[model samples]
Target: MVELRETRIQTRQRVQPDDTNNYGSAHGGMVMLWMDEAAAMSAIRFTGEWCVTAHVDGIDFRAPVPSGDTLYLDAYVYDAGRTSCKVRLRAYHEDPKTGSRTETTDSTFVFVAVDDNREPMPVTTLECSSEESEQLRAEAFAAFEE
Candidate 1:
């Protein structure tokens, strides 16, 4: 029963002379880095114990965000186990002037709580009380299947 909420992360990096590939877009690794950070934040909020990324189940680059575009990441924890939490992350490109948004990438990641020795630590049950929570739970399941 992880407590999940919409979390945001922003990073601005220009499509520098050296940052672009043949396509002149931000590298895939750069996008993934932001996604991981966003997911980690959600996981930490859900589990008080230190969390380590157990696995990144799936990362789909739905669109390419140009290097000059600002990347916005939204993440939330939707499910939890005794020691693991599932976080859903979405990356979008925002037009600074018009404030238009286009989703670029989305992924689901799992993190496990660990002690100082890096052993798995127990986590409390998640509490889902509202209709939104129920919808999130359903989405988490559908994402897991994908």
Candidate 2:
């Protein structure tokens, strides 16, 4: 069984020259890729099954991340259907020394669990017993409602 807390994933990546655009800022595509990976991990953790990204929405890029900054990605599964999990993904650009972060992007991704033959599979019901997970779940849901 996968609890709601286990579906919450946090990860980071260093912005290298290869990941940046002509302006020396991280390309939108690269940032989207990082968000996708983070959401994929959360979905796989929640379903314990092979999963693929079926849809994405609400991609809003608020800031640019210059090369040498750290890209912080956080994702969590806030809702699910019989076979699909909805994930909230957020990205931030961080100052390596100061640890201050600036919001860069926000989006939602839906991943569908798959069987051995790549057919959609049922997902276990998600639950959250701890206060932290519950709060995170609530805030994630509220963010999209805005």
Candidate 3:
């Protein structure tokens, strides 16, 4: 078994001019790319195998991240099947100097572990190592219930 906390991944990216859209906010596609990468990292960490994104559900963009803000992405595995891992992904925009953050987007991503031949392979069960990890897993399940 792999502990959920052990697979938790966080990444940061500074939103540069090139990462923005014409509206001067972070581009939706760019944000999705970042989310995918983070989610993949969580899945790979849990399974110890290459993982590919199978689905992204309800990608809600709640706010815009203006250029020059730091984008913080957090991801962790919440559930696992025989060959798939369900990851919860969230992105927040922070003022680099002040350190205030606002959630910009959130989504649930599913990834399938693959072998060297690219065939789906079984993954170990996920275990929550703490109350917080358990709470997060519950919240992820609740989000999908809606």
Model 3 earns a TM-score of 0.96
Predicted structure 1: clash tally: 1
lDDT of 3 by residue, 8-28 (tens): 999998999999999998999
- Cα lDDT tens digits for candidate 2, 1-146: 56788898999999999999999999989998989999999999999998999999878889999999999999989888999999989899999889999998888899999999999999998887889878978887888756
lDDT order, best first, reads 3, 2, 1
Model 3 misplaced regions, further than 4 Å: none
lDDT of candidate 2 at residue 135, scale 0 to 100? 91
lDDT value, residue 4 of candidate 3: 89
* TM-score of every candidate relative to the true structure: 0.83, 0.95, 0.96
Question: Model 3, 130: alpha-carbon shift in Å?
Answer: 1.7
User: All candidates' lDDT scores?
Assistant: 0.74, 0.91, 0.93
Q: Candidate 1: list runs displaced more than 4 Å.
A: 6-22
Taking the tens digit of each residue's C-alpha lDDT, what string does model 1 give over 45-117? 7787788999997677888777676777777777777889788777887776676889887678899999999
Minimal lDDT window, size 10, model 2: 137-146
Off by over 4 Å in 2: none
Total clashing pairs for each candidate: 1, 0, 0
